[model samples]
Target: MRRIIYDVAVSRDGFIAGSNGDVSIFPHTGDHVDAYNERLATYDTVIMGRHTYEFAYQYGLPAGAKAYPHMRHLIFSEGVQLPADAEVEAVRADFTTHISALKKEQGGDIYLCGGGMFAGLLATSKLIDVLRLKVAPVLCGVGTPLFANVSERIDLKCISSTLHESGVEYCEFNLQ
Candidate 1:
């Protein structure tokens, strides 16, 4: 079975993005850049919440545009419609069920691209297999926290960690 990895950049305070869905606070470069890209290349599918996709509005993707031509993109929303020609498909309300079916398909691991709320739901449901992160130095006092709305404790076992000169730490953990 394939695993779902929440491989994303995070703040010291555990936020995925700043308040109001601002994600510009995280640093972009470090020695970990290569490893980050490597992780991206490992997944054949990228998962994103509606808000997360909209956050990258600067890089406008018109209808029929393949955001990641090399990989499949899955956006979760209730009934929001995408452009008729958009390459991506909006997932149905039965997200968890559909996700399970995706996992059973022949493919590499899945990447949970963004949205703390979406990650929280996955974590809450005990569906996430890996919690992988790049910890940046910035501190967002108020922001969308990693694992937001997850009230219960989810234990994790650290698998490995690498600290870079830029003060960014690359870490991976397995759900316990």
Candidate 2:
């Protein structure tokens, strides 16, 4: 089966974004960004929440288009409609069914680029196979957590770790 991995960057305090939904605290420079870009190349498809999709489109889409040309992008949104774009698709159905069908058709790992709510949902349902997080040095006192409302203790094995020159530490945790 293809793995569903959540590859996100979070602050030292475990927040994915600041109180104002600001993700600027996440590292985006030096070897960390290079490593992240390289990691993204392994996936054939990228799945993301609506909010994340919007944010990416607003800030990162242009750059992402150049970096991940071969990858298909799927955005999960409840009611909002997606523009008719060749590079992006909006999925409005059940996540499990859609993801399963996608896996059967695409036949490669899926990267879940997320906002915390979607990650929390996937985590709660045990759908994520890996949790690859880049821990930044900054701290967000109160904001969206990396895994909000995740009740069960999902065990994970530390696959690898790397400390970047920018004070960012990348950690790969495989669901065990």
Candidate 3:
């Protein structure tokens, strides 16, 4: 079975975005961008929530370029529409079934590019196999957290970790 991995960046205080949904505080300096691009290359599919999609569409990736041409892009949203030129598709509401079928066809691990809500759903469903976080140095004292309502304790074993000169730390963990 293909693993579902949440690849997200959060503030030191564990917020994914600040109040008012601002993630502009995230640093784009040093080797972090290059390292992220490299990590993204390993996955054949990038799964995201509507908000995350909008954020990427606005900030991280350029439109119409098919940035990860070799990979399939899947968005989980009830109302969001995919761009005509995008190599992207919206996953059906029957998330579990659709995700399962996607895994069968893709034959590689799935990268969950998240917004907290989406990550929480996957976490609650016990569908995520890995959680990879890029911790930024700054802290948003009050903001959207990385995970919410994840009452069950899910143990994770650290696979690797790297601290960058730009004060961003990357950590990979496998759900155990």
Query: Among these predicted structures, which one has the highest TM-score?
Result: 1
Q: Give a tens-digit lDDT track for model 3, residues 1-176.
A: 78888888899998899887887889977787789888888898888777777776665675433446777888788977655776678775987677767767746788888878888888887788999899999989988889866778888899999998888999999987
Q: Report RMSD (Å) for each prediction in the order shown.
A: 1.4, 2.6, 2.4
Q: Give the TM-score of each candidate.
A: 0.94, 0.88, 0.86
Model 1, range 1-176, lDDT digits (tens) per residue?
99999999999999988888777788777777778987887889988888777666667865434566778989888855678878888896888888888888999999998788889888888889999999998999988889878998889999999998878898999997
Candidate 1 global TM-score: 0.94
Q: Model 2: which residue pairs collide?
A: none
Instruction: Give the whole-model CA lDDT for all candidates, comma-separated.
Output: 0.84, 0.81, 0.81
Which residue ranges in model 2 land beyond 4 Å of their true spot?
60-67
| Candidate 3: clashing residue pairs, number | 0
lDDT of 2 at 168: 93
Can you write out model 2's per-residue Cα lDDT over 114-146, one digit (the tens) per residue? 878888888887788999989999989988889
State each candidate's clash count.
Answer: 1, 0, 0
Alpha carbon deviation, residue 155, candidate 1 (Å):
0.5
lDDT of 1: 0.84
